[model samples]
Target chain A: MSTVLQSLSTELADAVESAGRAVVAIHARRRIPASGVHWQPGVVVATNHTINRDENITLTLPDGTTAPASLAGRDPSTDLAVLKLAGQSLPVASLRRDAPPKIGELVIALGRPGPGLTASWGVVSRADGPWRTWQGAEIDSLLRLDLAIYDGFSGGPLIDAAGRVLGINTSALARGVPVTIPIATVERIVTELLERGNIRRAYLGIGTQPVRVPESLARKLELKSDLALLIVSLESGGPADRDGLLLGDVLLELDGTAVNDASDVLAKLGGDRVGKPLAARLIRGGQVKALQLTPGERPTSRAA
Target chain B: MTASMTAGLAQEVAAAVDQLRQITVQVRTHRAATGAGILWNGGEPEGPGLVITNAHVVEGERATVELSDGTAARARLVARDLRRDLAALEFEPGRAVVGAVVRDSPPLRVGELVIALGHPGGLTGAATLGIIHRAESDREGRTPRWIRADVRLAPGFSGGPLADATGRLVGVNTMMQGGLALAIPAVAVEAWVRRSQTMAVS
Candidate 1:
């Protein structure tokens, strides 16, 4: 007798069979290989953290053939890396971009750690709006899963019951919690990485920590917000240092927006903001001083 | 979807678990650790009931088998292959026994729903649901060494039954590796039982 349970099982297996064709084993690191998806024609996407070395990368296709793949670029902020595969006929992942995954929706994670394709199933646990990573990259959406993660899971794809790609899975982001980098974000990064060979981010090169201004100081300075960021460290000869900003300055606003936290400063430091001058308001020598600081393009491997 | 559809799926799963529980038995040796076993037919239409468990779970020549109805029986070790980590126990069938129905053909597919019945943490007849992590290779006449699954299995779950969605036995839950449950495929177990029974008759 046909039952709903059997149908569910068969459909799930069919989904895996279809989606798994795009999943390939990436042999970039030592020991067990990681996973990568055939995102587009001649383009593969994987996790940045899993690619230990920049060169000498190879891939195991679904047909058990080994092919050399060149690393196009990597963005540590988003934990994503794009690789260029030449003359390969692998199928591209079918992406679901019209709608975001809902909470409690059944999802499967597919990985090709070895020649065999592995799968794990679970429900989407949490789905929220865009969030920023510690590296300052803003993910399109926060997709937390309730599934068990395994080896090579970092660079795999989180697929739905229909076998359509939802996002790229990564354990490096969110402090070891499995998070999916949505299709929108992946598409944006893949395009930029393929073009520029790296992600361009704006940086002030100054470290700040949130601090509470004393009520007496706040009243004297006529400050609008009681909380301000205290400049703790400055990169020598960096943008902030070159802009005449001191180490002990209390930053109150940037571009007329209140700067209460470090992320607030990051919110204004996108790639488009790199060569533009920003208005900064800070309390220097116990006096409100205004300065125009132009952010610089953050060099690769440098933290703000 | 109506409430009845959801309930129908739930009922189907519950019924599959019920069928699996009847074929599952608790295996206890002189050791402190307890494991589970599956009742087998011993290749005879009406012969003494046979229990299949892990060789690691049954160390001595004799171990105690407890049926689903809480009836205990003394069983003698009939066949053991340490390399395969499988052992067969023969016990008198004081009453009718339900043997596991093994799936014969059309090997497992990746992502198919599977159910595992075990006695984890001293809990009897506990069931956990998962999907087949990877299907066996399609090579003819060759069975994969282990059937890896995504199910969570504890120490007490060894020698239990890993059934498909329809409750047909697929593998014997043996050990866990890399957080994935590895099972001995039932087809291999059936072959071993046949060969072992032949050696006993010879």
Candidate 2:
């Protein structure tokens, strides 16, 4: 009477039962509560978009007890927020960080929108290399699911068949499409957010748009590429403005890398690049000009 | 070994679906499209069989029930409960039909596999597989109102059987809500059937 089908069902149920121990309902927003994972000791990880207000946040633990939680920090770029829970002996999520989830691998999304723990199973639809989000945060890996996302699915944990946490699921990262923030990215963000209460990135206060450089100008400037980014706006007294970089400068290269798109510029603006002077090559007054522009730490509230 | 195990799983699922299809019947009424019905009770020799479906599927007192083996018969509505969205129909089969084997003990677990057989979009015997989304806790020794599942159910899937992996009937697919399929637990349906049959006898 022992069949693979029955064993599979039992194992799946066992996995949900084991993993549901760490999943809790986060009451941070209106309407139905969202899900969060007890990631580390006294720490819970949830989605930033689900936390509507920072004050008066509470959590319904796996044992069906309500506990007050304080906001530790939030990183909107990764759609992750950390909360500090006190004096609760709850089990932490067992994270599978050694290997990334493969395409077509069986996975389950566990959430506790209310007192009940809900589960939905499916396969990993798309698993690709690292990709950048619209907010310029680089996710460690791209994980697109082929499962039904229920209400309060955001901030829930996507667990493997063995009941190990693969990543945190969020519907806000990919324009409402369900995507998981992998453990590598979550670990990095959790460390940084817990330490500094926010994520830091290097920013140059200027907006750029890709423009086709005139062939005559390209040939005269000895530029290798015919396309360059046109600096359209400059923030007053900002990093680029303070470095004497003018408006309408056709940016050709930054730190020896060709800059043909806005994302190309963002690739050079990681958190480590803050306060570091970068070699800039641009076309100013129909001539190639080189300048050392130091990048400043971006404000938490400012985009780009 | 892995390949055989996977094949075994697939074969077992196919067998379960086939067993469910035998007890599943296509219900047609003059007022609505073709829906599905479960063979609730396959009566004794020379007795009438009982079929259960959604009340919304059968508008009047009469309906046409077509078994999976292509046997068609005129059925009379025995009981209709709009509150529970359940209806019972009685039909005289030419021979003995198979009744659903409902799972009543060892309450369902969350994330346990569940299979649904329905006639979606007029398609006969369509089977879909999913897991139990949330298994309600029966603290008060009462059956939960609705058994919510993650399986997808279309318009023509109303009043079908939602069985477990081993093909035991768990619930009856009633309607869909918030993208989740809601079903009346088989135990609850059994209680309702008992009450209705008692009333009919009196």
Candidate 3:
């Protein structure tokens, strides 16, 4: 090999060595095996979809020792779960918040599918986002890897050529698409889970679905999107109903944010907007009407 | 890896790619398969011409072996050990292919550099670089069952060679676990092939 290639491989090998140390092999399910990476000193972040039972989880440390872990919190919308290892100290993977890896840059995915640390190499296919998954989960950062995910790959760390973690890759939210939940998203989710135990969402008390807006009305309204929310049902005297929103009224925007679909509305109704008066613009018949609604506390009974 | 769709490789190819490709074969099973194989004659005086691949690569009893130079041959299943995912095929030694150089590289340590040569996802002659993630026996003390590496092996990479930095075959790329490439070690492949040939002779 040329000196340049040798140097590249050697450097990459070093990165995987340090980063793989933070990767833990998680046997989240009694039957199915998965992987998790340490986000904090004792906190491991994993994909929520694989955690069948809420309790009695096991994590295989890089040293090959088993330790009991308890689920701290889980957000199904984003498919991320946090597990706290009992009295165990594991190496925390360093999250790179600086410049992102450029497109075409080499990336490696590390996981503990078995007792051993397994690796997969790919390239950063799509790295720009503050996008939402198809399930309507709001992600602060998004990464679509060119890498193909296999068994136990969900919840593993996706590292750049330098070994810095890009995010936690999960198959849950992507619906078979390879998506990586970036480090910033992992940090945010883990913080919320550690502090509040769950992501707080605002309640609209209305069921809605995405519908296409009439071209004539959309152009006159100077709307940027072709999709709008069609209100299906209002929870008796709920936020939308109380705010003078009638059934069948098309929702265009909430607090200046476009409500293109049900997920878009859900994405806007985050916990921060709860108890806040939000200006909602909707098209009733052929006219666009603006109304004010104070978002209420979301019921904990509602599954994400 | 969404940065760019790299048809050739996710990472850059090194100086050893040409050497690696010569011994690599795009091993396609008659069961409608996608896999890579290594051309190994084993220096056997009688019926030594063989193609080494994963047991799962071949279906029924027949397969089409495409050599590195694009020569295709019809091969018959010789022997297989499903437990280890290793199998051998007897074919006419038409291509002057040499067995992969088996180096003395042993005690495979984590973070050691390696490369994988295979036809991943039907993209023939693709290569990926990685490190030896782990190399060990299972709980049953099965020595060198798998060589776990970070090198990406997609649907078509199975049965290819996972070689060391020097381009010597160390393992036969097989299945994947959690996206990591799993391979049957070269030593294990040699043993399996030797045992299968002896059985065929008897």
Candidate 4:
């Protein structure tokens, strides 16, 4: 018993010590607190939602010192962003390249939200995903954590018991619900954001609102979700306008994924789908209609 | 997608969860205030036992305790210390209630294995595991000094037990302090219970 306890103690202590070195606190506008990982030398990856402004970014490193960081790029579709610092190089977190973590294994979310490191431990609540968020952006994997993502943990790493970072935990895009943006997705988004300033998203050029699908129509179309998107307006000369999409149509499905709300349509509008012809199924005049329309590039006028 | 349930650690955790399930129960107060509490002997088994929880989780003067087997009875709020965030509820003895043997807590070092049982987010009988981060005194060195641990606790987890790897209750899961999950040492809770018992007898 003594031996078992001692071995476990050593493992956990080492995990915390090594992982803490890479966790840094990020402060954006209004002093909104967050955590980030030193994935690459002098490159910190954090969540985009907690970061309201790109200018005047500051980071608190593990050595108990602060440094000014510059925003390199950010992609809100995946809720990930990158920052560059001219400060000293920190040891990058070791990421496990082995099999994906099991559902019930021990995992810890660590961050230096303040002067010292703060840790939260729990099991992987759920790890099954090749699914898409409501924004319709592709997520390589979805990892739901039972651990609490407290004030400074939004961008922290959810590492295994061995201290290998599994993913960047963020609740920003998930509406405060903890979801891990996996390493594969993080690398892809960071590369694109660094090159393009923002990830391109396809748009149908229609402002829509969520409304309940009439029960009669739902049963007729065999739709899974009871809600649909009702077109309120359109960007003149945009994809929907060019396709003669009416203003009163309620979107039921886009590219086979059921559109439950405005977010559902927006989710599938990510840059990868831009310029591709997509099948939009809508209910016009109480009848399900299918239309072929090529998605246009999403406007970049919204403030970050 | 794959099972990491190796034979050794999986067996140990399963056994501990089984032992913990026997003593854990749900505490309910008015206006839907709910949390987890542990059953313990108030003084003697023949006398009514008490359900221990956090003072901030005190739902009302008369709180309902639901046992593991789903039996419930209203427990009287016998004593409460808000300063320590500890509360003890005396209720009728049903069957036999086993109290958790809390360790001295000092011998526990940083990174020692620990498990927590609580009703977090309204879900009862939930258990999560972590390690002790290290115990430290607050700035003022006043009451409610804590041994912070890595075990995660949500809103409904307040007033529950942070047990050792062997399932012995070592601390009461309180709130977060200094960015870590904080718990009141079991010695503090035991001392509070002793004072409450002495006061009742006097």
Off by over 4 Å in 4: A29-32, A207-232, A249-270, A273-292, A301-304, B1-112, B115-129, B133-145, B152-181, B184-202
RMSD of every candidate to native, in Å, equals 1.7, 1.7, 5.8, 8.7
DockQ of each: 0.71, 0.74, 0.27, 0.15
Each candidate's clash count: 0, 0, 13, 5
What digit string (tens of lDDT, one per residue) describes model 4 on residues A1-304? 4334346556776787788889898988475478999988878899887788879998888877899999988766677889988858789988886778779878877766666676767789888967676555788887888776656677888888788999899886567777888888888887887788777878888888889987887898887888888899988899999998989888888898887667677667777788898898888988879998789887664334
Q: What order do you get sorting by TM-score, best first?
A: 2, 1, 3, 4
Q: For model 3, what is the error of residue A67's alpha carbon versus the real structure, in angstroms, after optimal superposition? A: 1.1
Q: Which scores better on TM-score, 1 or 3?
A: 1
Span of 10 residues, lowest total lDDT, candidate 2 chain A: A295-304
Structural similarity to truth (TM-score) of each candidate: 0.97, 0.97, 0.76, 0.64
Clashing pairs in 2: none
Q: Write the per-residue lDDT of candidate 2 for residues A1-304, one digit (tens) a residue.
A: 4388889998999999999999999999899999999999999999998998889999999888999999999988889999999999999999997888999999999999988899988999999998888878889899999999998689999999889999999999887778999999999999998999999999999999999999998988788999999999999989999999888999999999999998899899999999999999999999899999999998897221
Q: Which should have the higher TM-score, number 2 or number 3?
A: 2
TM-scores, chain B, all models: 0.95, 0.95, 0.84, 0.88
Index of the highest-DockQ prediction: 2
